[model samples]
Target chain A: MAESVSEVRAWVNQRRGEGRTIGLVPTMGFLHDGHLSLVKRAKAAGHAVVMSIFVNPLQFGPGEDYDRYPRDIARDRKLAERTGVDLLFTPSVEEMYPRALQVTLRVGDLANRLCGLSRPGHFDGVATVVAKLFHIVEPDEAFFGEKDYQQLRIIQTMVEDLNLPVKVIGCPTVREADGLAMSSRNRYLSPEERRRAAVLSRALFDAARRCREGTTRAAELVQSVTQQLSSAGLEVEYVSAVREEDLGQVDQIDQPCRLLAAVRVGETRLIDNVALEAGKGMGHVSAYVDR
Target chain B: MAESVSEVRAWVNQRRGEGRTIGLVPTMGFLHDGHLSLVKRAKAAGHAVVMSIFVNPLQFGPGEDYDRYPRDIARDRKLAERTGVDLLFTPSVEEMYPRALQVTLRVGDLANRLCGLSRPGHFDGVATVVAKLFHIVEPDEAFFGEKDYQQLRIIQTMVEDLNLPVKVIGCPTVREADGLAMSSRNRYLSPEERRRAAVLSRALFDAARRCREGTTRAAELVQSVTQQLSSAGLEVEYVSAVREEDLGQVDQIDQPCRLLAAVRVGETRLIDNVALEAGKGMGHVSAYVDR
Candidate 1:
């Protein structure tokens, strides 16, 4: 495990000197099964896997959890090593951003939808830090969880636009046994809220199933998901059926799309999405909790 | 000379296969001696030099002469080949931006002062295009003229912040025998305005001399330069003494500073700057005009 940029560079250079391809998996710590799964996929690609655990303050908005983002270095280090990670990089805020950061990398309208609609400047922060990491790590391939569906899309677009050499691979979202998406923030939920939090993913899965069964109207699908979360004692922030490519909201499902929802169960915000294929029986939805 | 990205990449890979270091010099065409001088520096670095001539629309605001920007592919190709350039990449706007540019790389306060204050979003465009070039070229070193001092500083800061592997080397500003700074825009000047354009460099020279001779007050130095240009039949846009690193306008010349000035000679806009060391002598002034 290395905590400094110079040390990581030395390590990466030594590997590159031997012509070994490198892979990177960037995470905000509190290592979940989802992150470990990305590490496994990265390793499977004949890459020397490097995982970075940085709870980037740049990605958090004001009044958001910049200060209190969950971090446990000891626990994270153990899990990362157990997952066969070749190197674990845990950099402090000062290490990553030595000075006040003024430079920004931003995506266009893609950043103005779904989660971005509420958490303004969130994707910009994600794009900037990931860009910095991509340069510093110089990995041949980078793995990201499709759990952050919007983030994955933004990163893909950025790499293509900038002509960055690294390939971006998105692994499927890792979920819990109760059909809840695995997230670090799940730890913030109370026992009661944790049980209710599963409703977010349940709603996405159910809506995706409906879309696959010819529920093509965007308004009807959104309203149904919104009502489902509300009935489950969650406050729905947005229920969107957005095109997979540009993230533009689709009026009718004529092509592949994503059914995404963000809900607040108590003070903890949770988001989940499932891909929807046009017409009956083609889409794959995660297991749904029966009422 | 390669006009496409894939061809350039293949060439770059061939060179890297032999373990030769690569250098890049990016320009908007109509090659001048200033650009050739950078090629010499790049060659001197023992690098296989690659030059890109792209008149990026992203950098030009509406009505900002993007259409009129000078370009001569035949002449430029000849000049570049004569200078030992291994590859010349002249990508069309469509090749460079296949889609509408929805991603931007921005350097904040550093970009908002001096030239940026007059030309909003200009530096952002420069930053974005350069970033894309850096990734595509993957050069070991990139050469830039100090003639665009603020731009050079912005690129340096962006490289540092983004952890880009390439070294950004700023060569001293190249000038003509008449003391006018070398620029593609200089061709826009009429013969009389061309003669007057030298005043921009002269004022910067005089201001730098004054600073070296214990003229510490920024206002006094700016006033002297502004008056000099005004008397020389040039429309003074801004005369500023700024810190060399951050591009911050300094109220007093207690530190190493840059004396920057912009002027309009008829319809042509020209800018020039000189580094000021706070002591006697040892500064190179472009030309005295000897009127």
Candidate 2:
């Protein structure tokens, strides 16, 4: 386990000396099936896998669950080893941020929509930390779960726009038996809320089913999904279809777009999405399993 | 000459295959003696040097010199080959910015000072371009002339803050026989403005002399330099002494700091600075030469 920036860098440097390619999986700890799936993908790619578990404070709002964010070093270490991770880095907040950050990254208009609308400065925080990790880990490829679809696209866009020296790979979103997208925050849900959380995925699947059947207007899908989540007794933050790249609102699912939603089930806030495309590049997007 | 992104990336990959360390020197074309000096330093460091020449449009303000900024590609080609640069990349605006950039960088408090004050968004442009260049070229070490001291420091801070994977080297500011710092914009100065431009450096040297003789107060140094530039028929934009790292205003030269000044000589605006330290880290900061 690498605990400092220099330690992980030195480890990567040594591996690079041995002619080994590296794949990175960045997460906020309390590793679940979703994160491990990414690790499996990285290992399957014939590259040494590195996983980082730093709950970056910069990405969390003051009112958010930064303080209560899940962490389990022992379990994480065991799981990482079991999953074939070559290196597991868990740098402290102090180690990652030695001082107040004077230089940071801010996303453009793409941030003004979706989750960025309510959780302001959130994506900027995510971009800044991800950029820092790319620098520190110096991995050839990095993996992200598509459950956070907007975040995955944001990271991909940042990499392209900034020409960051890493290939961002999006893994299929992992879901529970009931269709709730697997998340660390699912631990915050009560038994009843956990059952209700399945509605989020149901809504996404409904939209996907509708889009596949030729009803591709984004507004219609969003309105139907919003009704489903609201009727499930969840506080719907947003339900919309946005461009896969910039999250720009689209009138119809002309290209690959994501149907994203955020809802509060009891006190636990959860978000999920599934990719939809009526035109092209729909093969790898999340599919609603007929459970 | 590498004119496209893929071409440059392929060239760099081949170079990397041979285990050759790369040095990058980014410029806005119209190569001058100052740029050659940076190239010379890169060659001396024994790395295969790659210099990029692109006048970034995003960095310019409404009335600023984006369109009129100097360009002579044929002359630049001759100069790069003459100076031992292995690869010269001159990507076009369309190539560097194929799409309207949705993801870009913004420097924090450090950018709100000095040149950043009057020319707002200038360092952000510099930071963004440099970051892109760093990604595009994958250089081992990048050279920057200390003539743009604030810019050099911002790049360094960005590199450190974000843990960017390149060494940012600061070459001593190359100056003329009359003590005026070398700049590409010096081409814009008329014969009359050219002579008066010498006062900018003189004010720097005077402040250095005063600091050496125990007058290390920043306010006192700024006032003296302002008086000298104002009396020399130049419009003073600002004269400041700031910390070497963040460009934070320093009350006294207790640590390594920089005395920065900008003045308009006739229709041309030129800026200059010399480094000072009453305590430590003074060895490499810019020193005023005895003309």
Best by TM-score: 1
| Model 2 misplaced stretches (Cα beyond 4 Å) | A277-285, A288-291, B277-291
Candidate 1: list runs displaced more than 4 Å.
A280-291, B282-291
* DockQ of every candidate: 0.76, 0.78
Instruction: Give the clashing residue pairs of candidate 2, or none.
Output: none
**C-alpha displacement of B180 in model 1, angstroms?**
0.6
| Lowest-sum lDDT 10-residue window in model 1 chain B | B282-291
Candidate 2 lDDT, A158-177, residue by residue in tens: 99898887999998888888
Q: Put down candidate 1 lDDT per residue, B182-260, tens digits, no spaces.
A: 8999999888888888888877887878877888889999999999899998998898889997988889888878888
